[model samples]
Target: MSELILGIESSCDETGVALVRTREAPGQVPELLAHALHSQIEMHQAYGGVVPELASRDHIRRVLPLTDAVLREAGVALDAVDVVAYTRGPGLAGALLVGAGVASAMAAALDRPTLGVHHLEGHLLSPFLSADPPQFPFVALLVSGGHTQLMRVDGVGRYALLGETIDDAAGEAFDKSAKLLGLGYPGGPALSRLAGEGDARAFKLPRPLLHSGDLDFSFAGLKTAVLTQAQRLGQALPERRADLAASTQAAIVEVLVKKTLAALAATGLQRVVVAGGVGANRLLREQLDAACAQRGVRVHYPELHLCTDNGAMIAMAAAMRLQGGLEQPRRDYAFDVKPRWSLEEISASIP
Candidate 1:
């Protein structure tokens, strides 16, 4: 019988669960049987950023129902699940615990093995969930609220960090910039939407560190540039808001695309994969797509749903690890959360 893995993700504001069945034979892709996600956007809308305690509470409330829903949708008995996988780290500690606790307990009850999945690994591998996934040995740009990194992904579980943010991540820059413009919470998407109506040339924001000849990114300076421009305007000019948004978005996208290209060139990898929430930005996608097209480099991204935190990617990563014969969870093993986990620390054998 094919091994069935139950995946749970609660690294932040979303509670997700999924079931994936491995192929009967080796060297074949796993099939996603069911997937469910519950976003706490409305719950956190009042807060500018996520509240760890509230996020953990919400996950505890929704995870069980979501797991039930996914199992029912897949017509898979909980007892039949071969493994349980949960996001293990680099997220709000409290939130990570909620999922890890539940997954470990559930797996114990089912007498099945469990796996602790790295949150970023889930994001990096998400593109595989899409049709026409890129092959191994590609460059991955992981841009999100918490991280901005360039990685060399030779295969599953094998990731080499090429460059990363020295300060605020690109998505954090977007959110902060949007907040300065009076955009609501979860500002990245809101700001991107407003950017669509603005003139990209109107504000002329700085493209920080773009010419630094270093793979390291520094968005803090660019964010400061936006602040300086806003101050120069002397007030929130409602009419110019869109223009500012567009200009900021343009500068950010340019930096990202250029840095990714640099990474690709340095690594000599023709295939590039974009992951994380910021990867869903239309402008970034367009610019990267165009740039890659010009250079004969292929760019891959997860489908819109997989671009953000989700369980399918967690399950996929766990399945790959298990298949690769990585260490399995022991029943006596305790649940632990890594609030500051690093991607380079992930075991190399699974990738």
Candidate 2:
């Protein structure tokens, strides 16, 4: 019962392609064979944010080539693929269409089945791509540039929403604050790198919803505080930018960590899975590890590279869903993408 799955992802600025092999045993974890990713970071850097049209065009150019490279790297033939997988929703419509179109076309030409994957579900299951994967019945903290959410994962396709951001996500807060401090495009990582050089206690910053008696998050006030601080510093801003960045990161991380712990407590789950791009934050990992360890709770993260969106996660998610009987690949090639889909909707869609 081995099946080769080819996965495509173009939900945003990255065009990714990967191959994964499902094992004979239904419970065995799917294995990643080869994967390729092309990030639009450098191209988008000029704009200080992603430009959807350019992103879609780049995806159109990159997806096929990346798919070729992946197949070569894995030493697999296109005809050997049993299924073609692609990111379906919760992303840029045009970008999503590029991947969906390519994937469905390939599957149709090869006479193979196709699976449409949710972008966040790929993020949620990404940790399985790591050397160490968590068991079921765990709490998941999914923080990315556009989303921040906590959920109780009972098993494949079984998820319960615990809490989520009410305003800006953690990654948004990081990037927006970085922009406010004059850091250019892809501000989150830039702010994080600069934060390492400054003292976290240098400035007092707001930690939104830290004591709201609920698991919801709100980072708008924190971003506003950062804006106010930058304005107050005025000409001296450059001299103290690192401190501001550090303090801002601290504020965001503190809220994420505390809320995750609260979610674990509420769900009574002993393990927590951290996924998505923001999970790559060194400080967030350190703080969460420290806090969770004291309570004898295990924390798991995707391999550093896998924390960002990639085809491996997409392939892995599709494979897992199929293995769990949660999804069945369809033959119809006509496909659509969801540009504004939410996790709540994903939960509702799960059978």
Candidate 2 C-alpha lDDT tens digits along 300-326: 999998888899999999999888778
Q: What is candidate 1's lDDT per residue for 151-259, written digit by digit as tens?
A: 9988777889899999999999999999988899889999999999999999777888899898999899888988888888776568888999999999999999999
| TM-score versus the correct structure, for each prediction | 0.97, 0.98
* Deviation from native of the Cα of residue 311 in model 1, angstroms: 1.0
Best by TM-score: 2
C-alpha RMSD of candidate 1:
1.4
Q: Least lDDT summed over 10 consecutive residues: which range in candidate 2?
A: 342-351
The stretch of ten residues in a row with the least summed lDDT in candidate 1 is 324-333
lDDT values of the candidates? 0.90, 0.92
